[model samples]
Target: MSTPTTVALPTDMELVLKVFPMPKDSNNNGDIFGGWVMAQVDLAGAVLPARYTCGRMATVAVNEFIFKQPVQVGDLLSFYSKVTKIGRTSVQVLVEVFAERRVLGNQYVKVTEATLTYVAIDENGRPRPLPITELQPRRQY
Candidate 1:
């Protein structure tokens, strides 16, 4: 096995989610499943948009998803996110996942990056315009 590359975490994006992958989430190769990571990314991507939607929203599209490194069991994963665009009824976000390797003295390695779009939805589950009041700057995350 090669030495895991260590890098600094992002300072611009908000740290949205932090999770530790367990053995149950691993695959035959002992690495965490890609699908599981994607699920977490989808959840992480919505954090910022939730503030703007201020009511209800649904994931409209996963514009892009890239897995750069394999995640291992016991790795402490930190998901960071930033809003890339905000349309009248949709919000686009960029999410980056970094792992603090458990076996490598908790060194950080960027493992995944994804772009996802979410649409504000009404109680009936139809798309709706974002609330204007929520668009104004509020407390920072």
Candidate 2:
């Protein structure tokens, strides 16, 4: 076995969402539930889809997810997302979660990352086509 090299995500990240986890969100073991973090990612990914799709959309799949670090109490979590790929009716977004430790001042670290796929939808909740946009390439992390 070998260690997987972690590549820093692109810096052209768009901050799509943010939220502070409260103490009540803790689990029995006192660690923040992974499910809560996932929900935040979903909400974060949905922001651009709702705008780009010009209507409602739904999460079709989670292509990849990795937890690079843990999130603890008093950490300020920020979710950054960007459109990585677009299709006729689907869009792929990469969401990165960074957490700022309470006692560490401005020091922050990447805590999680996930690739989310969403499908444009119409009022009836049926799949719809995506619109064209000037696609920009994100390079820095």
Which candidate gets the maximum TM-score versus the true structure?
1
Q: Which residue runs does candidate 2 get wrong by more than 4 Å?
A: 1-10, 133-141
The stretch of ten residues in a row with the least summed lDDT in candidate 2 is 1-10
State the lDDT of candidate 2 residue by residue for 1-141, as single tens digits: 132233443477787766888888777877667889999999999876665677778999999998877667777888999888888888898999988765665666788899999998888989888774446444344
TM-score of 2: 0.83
Q: How would you encode candidate 1's per-residue C-alpha lDDT over 1-141 as one tens digit per residue?
A: 345578899997889999998899999999999999999999999988998898899999999999888998888999999888889999999999999986778789989999999999999999999885244453565
Clashes of each: 0, 1
Cα distance off (Å), candidate 2, residue 86: 0.5
CA deviation > 4 Å runs, candidate 1: 1-4, 133-141
For residue 141, model 2's alpha carbon misses the true position, in angstroms, by 22
